[model samples]
Target: MTDTPTTLVTATGDSAGKTAITVALARLAADQDSSVGYMKPKGTRLQSNVGKTLDQDPMLAREVLGLDAEMHQMEPVVYSPTFVEGAIRGTEDSEALRNRIREEYDDIAADHDQVFVEGGGSWTTGGVVDLTDVDVAELLNANVVLVAEYGSPNDLDDVLAAADAFGDRLAGVVFNKVSDDAFESLDQDGIPFLESKGVTVFGALPYEKELAGVTVGELADELGAELLTDASTDAFVERFLVGAMGGDEALRYFRRARDAAVITGGDRADVQTAALD
Candidate 1:
């Protein structure tokens, strides 16, 4: 492993905003005049680009961070169906894969003062290939920064469990997508409680609806939907509603929504008209 400081941004559960935290940390480091690099050792979300299969998160991070490393080095192992099947069938060589990831990471570390590695789904992800977030952190000799999304008090259990899993390698935890009440509770009670247990609470971020929103084009792409109107596809959609009720009811529901898309049958022109109205 290299002497350059490396940090693995992992999560307590799925969709825990690992990429967002990684990007944010990298940007912060860059703003401090530090050379920052990024990587996602095992990519779970696959997307095809120009006949090449790649992980979508790392691709977006590279563009957002403006890193010069090639995409292949940033995401070394993609957990495609074939790769998973081979691992299950005991046909893939785990050691060789690990070596490749290390080599790529070393290359990145050679030129940068800090390298931020974003973990797949969660800490236990990639167990099939023996490349979980914990495993990758140990392999790279990197410290862990676990990101957890707070829904209730029960979520603290997940953070404690992850702290146990990472041991001293875990630097701290960041609570993301927290509600107003939850944020106050965490600040007043939760942070002290976790610190008493030897787990550091870095920060609790308040929930921002706009940050969680998706563009209309992304929604259409996810649903394989066709746009029938000339409206801007770049508009951000914060939520969605179903227009299955009467025209008045649908209109009332639609009116209450902010930047939301309505889903209904194509034959129901009344519902469509209500949504439009």
Candidate 2:
């Protein structure tokens, strides 16, 4: 086991902003003059680059942190469809993959003061290959910082479950994308409740539209919609409003939103014009 401290930032569920938290923590460490390194041992979001399959999150981390390590060292296992199928068919060598992840982690740990390992969509992800977030944390002897999106007070149950799953290795839990109303309640009530249960609450981050929004390009890709205009696709859309109301009401609704997208039919010229306006 490496003496260097490592953190595994995982989420309670899908779209819980694990990557965001990991990146934020890495940036904070870097700002404090600490040599920070990042990794995603079992990557599910795969992208092809230079004839090699790579994980997108690690690539973003590598660029953001200005890390000198190569992509292979940052993401040792690309959990693509083929890789999963191999695991299912017993064609993939699980031990070999685990070894590769450890070797890569050691390589990164050797050069940095701290290493941040981002997990997959959820805590239980990668069970087929025996490399769930908890599994990796145990493999690297890492402290786990589980990120969760706050929906209600009941979400604390999930945190407790994670604490049980991670046991003493759980460093803390962070509530992300919390709404304005939920923020005060979580800060006052939720934090104390979890702390009473011996679970540390790192923070309850209020929801920020800019941070939660999806890029227009990503939205288009997910919806399979072709762009008809030359609008900048990089722009983010935090909310989606249907243009079923009158033009004036639609305009009023649009004005209230920070970064939003309007969904309407082509024949509704009034709504379309209002949206454009």
Candidate 3:
């Protein structure tokens, strides 16, 4: 595959599902009997294992995708609190980090037909260490795929800005989390506009409520709240409604939404019941 073809999956903003798409593509290639590797060069989410702080995403990729690369090689520069603090204090070694990432990526790429490199949370992430997603893509000479959640007109602007930034390196764009109405607008106006501007639209994935949702247990853990009810932890929450309004208004809003998690005060029995019902 042209000596390990590499693709960098980046995004315009957080929660754009960059990792999901990267893994999906990797799995697809692997299922087709192609050797696929995965890496996340600069990671923000750190996990502590026996006092060794490791990046979470690459570990996920390695375990889930059965990647052959070692954990250290898959995740080269973990943005730990101390690491970032040291960078801020001018004690961090930027060149050393770059060398480590380049060396690991070279080794990983050498062993596979293609490698999927997952970028940081956002395009501008890791600027403190001079290793933004764009910088990484340029460093590795990888084709870029920018993922953006298509909700508003500003999303189109962000994708266009990414196209401007990446120029010829940009392979295409994947629009995610587009609702029915937004998809209609994007198919009619946004895709045509981007095409007119010489941008490649690879795919526009419609918003799937089940796939885009967070489980109730996940939400509880995120908020540090105890789940008091015996409701199923696997229940997905695609929308969150937070307020105390009149019964009619609440009913109207509840009826409009599917798989919603309503958060209100303890005394707001009306909203609570409305949500539960």
Best by the lDDT measure: 1
TM-scores, all models, native as reference: 0.79, 0.77, 0.77
lDDT tens readout by residue for model 2, 19-78: 888999999999999999999987777774223587788888988889889888888888
**C-alpha lDDT (0 to 100) for residue 52 of candidate 2:** 53
- Comparison by lDDT, 1 against 2, better one: 1
What TM-score does candidate 3 reach?
0.77
Clashes of each: 0, 0, 0
Residue 137 displacement in candidate 3 (angstroms): 1.0
- The regions of model 1 sitting more than 4 angstroms off are 48-52, 214-277
Best by TM-score: 1
Question: Which rank order by lDDT, best down to worst?
Answer: 1, 2, 3
Query: Candidate 3: where is the Cα deviation over 4 Å?
Result: 1-3, 48-51, 214-235, 238-277
- Clashing residue pairs in candidate 1 (N, C-alpha, C atoms within 3 angstroms): none
lDDT of 1 by residue, 124-225 (tens): 988888899989999999999999988667788999999999999999999989988788778888888999999998998898876879999988999898
Candidates sorted by TM-score, best first: 1, 3, 2
